[model samples]
Target: MKKIVLIIALLSPLFTYAQNKPNKKKGPTTYDLLIGTYTSGTSKGIAVYRFYAENGRLAYLSQIDGVTNPSYLTLSSNNKFIYAVNETPKGEVSSFSFEPKTGKISFINKQSSEGDDPCYVGVDKAQKNVFVANYSSGTVAVLPVNKDGSLSKAIQTLHDDGAHGPNKDRQEGPHAHMSILSPDEKYLLYNDLGTDKVNVLRYRASNEKPLEPASTPFVSVKPGDGPRHLEFSADKKHAYLITEMGSNVLVFDYDNGKLKQKQTITLLADNFKGQTAGAALHLSPDGRFLYASNRLETNEIIVYAVNQETGELTFVQRQPSMGKNPRDFAIDPTGKFMIVANQNSDTIYVLRIDNATGKLSPTGSRLEIGNPVCLKFAPAQ
Candidate 1:
């Protein structure tokens, strides 16, 4: 009887883990998520958390200290290293080696971003280089990765020469908002808010200098659409982009390793329209749904049913973020849940997905932090 009891206890967790896997009938994948936050004003660093998709619960894991304003995080393809954007208007990018066992991060190294206020960072498809978008200076930089997954000094930075829009206050200077890796890793796409164009660059194997634009910077949304971030489809045939200043989503036709605009749709609530409200856009892992967040007038996520063939979007549903000013949010690896970091309310909220309808429901688990800006997840062994 004692042996049987021990055996059952040992197998119980396995059972739970099995249950966390995808249920085809239910249509959602259970995910384990690790999130990093912007600890501004108080700590000026990053915070990590473990989100369990099965129960919609977030477990506080570990943190890295002495780092200032670690705002955006990018995990390597092998999940061995984490690259973060330190929002020091005059700051640098920091790298941390990931310990899968404890979900902890050890500082690896830091390098000048080649410009000031780097708000975004991305690892290339080859995982040999890092790209940063510096907002204040309107520049995009490329840094090489060291052998041990640490960082080498930034070798190149590009200052955007152009400006756009009629509004003097918002369009006064160039603001490079995000740096993203194309699926093939052949090109680096930098979304510039100030210029309303996606700065494109070709990555060369042998780099004397890696900072020049590949072709001309690809023009995205119309002037003042202000594209902020972009995500490619799983098949790499289409791209979905979001505009922060204009509150719109633009679909693009992608082929021959290039992106061309297809359609643009509004991401605002019908009854409430005053100013731009959209912030971030992400596609489901299955590539069947697209989720976008709105901040200014209403704090909620707008869901769209995606047509996989043409990359078009149809309205699905909208769910309140359950917190204020969701500056950024991330979907878990398993695709079962989404965690939103509310910057204004200083809390993180968990939401459960209804797979059939593609809607979100509050999970009632919330963590309070100061200026939670970015979130990511690492695996738990």
Candidate 2:
């Protein structure tokens, strides 16, 4: 009996110590938040904040100025560099070297977009090339990335050759909205809103002029859909597209740079006839749910459950973004929260994501900035 008591006493302290030890999970608790804005309003340039994963919150850390109308941002695969499109009458693409630890960016250089009103920017995984979608000019331009993180003159420029979309007001000319890379980075999806087409371009990172038309060429959406952002599934088996004028989503079965239409889902109610312009679409971190944002009269985010096997999207929930003009929103790496960037409201709302049902609830967390059109996340210590 005494021996048993002694053994229990010895093990009690060890058990208590083990229980009190901190969790050693491999997930990061915080990430660096990079925000791009139109300098015409309250913002002067790009902004950075530390995003807390445990609780949905943001702490301002650093910012850099002098770059005008940084309406969109894309970070390198390594997160060491950032490229932004200067959305101006005279379009330009700017480059910056990023310090993730400090959330600080140093201006590198800039180059003409070879077209007007550059809006979307994308960088290759090898960090060798930068692609910009000149929105007004309806052209896609590619520039080489220098060793020092600067941007060289455009090497290749391709114009969208198609008749204007049906919408005479917004589709008078070709507008390349976004440039999204394939999951394997073998192809580039050029989304032209004015032409209502997603052009597939072969991406050869090692070549001087990398973007050539793919074998499949392009995928045409509804005449007035105004295709905007397109996101690929993590497995590369499916793709989702958001249409601005149509206020709907189109699903595609993706195989080797070829996309076959599968399902089409509308983000609107049966009789709701208010003005709406879809802006951004992104899959959840787990790829189990897809979220699309819209602006104008309907300022809300629509959540849909992704059918894993079929790549079909079923409506899950639709919630107001709690502000106006929710242009871009990002899901955190932990999959616990989503921050909606409302451009006209100058507010970004952090909403709690329901993991089980893919519903979003207000967390009472918000950040106010001027003309925040883009939000991006990167790893931080």
Candidate 3:
């Protein structure tokens, strides 16, 4: 009995140790890449991919179909819901319930955008209001978000119709390009590319009609600038507006829903000037760098060093996007990798970002997708 007990005691510790051993062969860290595409071509709907960060590789997972022309996508604050613009003449905004564990999304419901050819969708910081920008109709729609992640009918549609910009062809009428909320969520700013103005709307999430024109209704940029997108500095004191037609970045001093132009800089080199249109602007997670994408002839990313105190930009380096007509790009959560969605080339290029110098180097990894217009990332489960 004593011998048997000794053997059992020795084996029990070994068994416990074996059961409690740490997993040395750890699984690769992965992220969910949600791609929004123009469904006019081969793309049916939103495409999802599993991005292996360690190797800079992407594996196709699944796609959410049935929603047409989901060219832009945004997520709820809790990461429980996703919203996309239907980008049709009869515009709509669709909602989906996100499954983090499986990296799958289920359609919830869609609501009328109250305007034509909706191009951008964004959720306010409070997550109680959803906003959409209609390009063709030159209107901004505000809808209330239900607790269950569904959207109510638009409560207000603000239209901007007035004198057109200098570009007679593209700016004949009001063309609302993007709607973005101030960092504090106290104000909503919509960029009107056709009107050459940025409209500021006072927002109160708790109100029945959450949007009202601010004291200063709109701020006019250069006549032909055609501001398409705006990004706020981390301090909320500076705003950067990227002009689509002019291919320039405008810096503004922001305070209490007013924007004063501070400086304007061109996105291309001084000597080499080919056709270039600014497509997108993004500030790095750390606020040290600002990146702007140029489509048309340039097809490159212009990097600028951000002055931490002044919020001014110093031109850094421009890197070829490795594909044609780069429409949008996103920086990974870790700030280590950036993925560019080239709309014309039908390819997604992965590039490594140098944290110190704000330089981008290609990872030689690319994924082929049709008409990819936007790239968004969510943390893996």
Residue-wise C-alpha lDDT for candidate 1, range 121-180, written one tens digit per residue: 998756778989998898888899987888998878787776665557777778899888
lDDT computed for candidate 1:
0.79
Predict model 3's lDDT versus the native.
0.91
- Candidate 3's residue-wise lDDT over 68-112, tens digit each? 999999988787899999999999999999876577889999999
- Maximum-lDDT candidate: 2
Output the better candidate (1/2) by TM-score. Answer: 2
Error of 2 at 298 (Å): 0.9
User: What residue pairs are clashing in model 1?
Assistant: 34-376, 34-377
Q: Candidate 2: where are CA atoms >4 Å away?
A: 1-25
lDDT of 2 by residue, 1-381 (tens): 999999999999999999998889768879999999999988999999999999988999999988899999999988899999999999999999999999989998899999999999998888888899998899999999988889999999999776688889889879998888898889999989998899999999988788899999999998999999999998889999999889999999999899999899998877998999989998888999999998898899999999989999999898999999999999999999999999999999999999899999999999999998999999995
* Each prediction's whole-model lDDT (CA): 0.79, 0.92, 0.91
Top candidate (TM-score): 2
**lDDT over C-alpha atoms for residue 155 of model 3:** 91
* Weakest lDDT window of 10 consecutive positions for candidate 3: 22-31
Root-mean-square deviation of Cα positions for candidate 3 versus the true structure, in angstroms: 6.1
Error of 2 at 62 (Å): 1.0
Q: Which stretches of candidate 3 lie over 4 Å from their true place?
A: 1-29
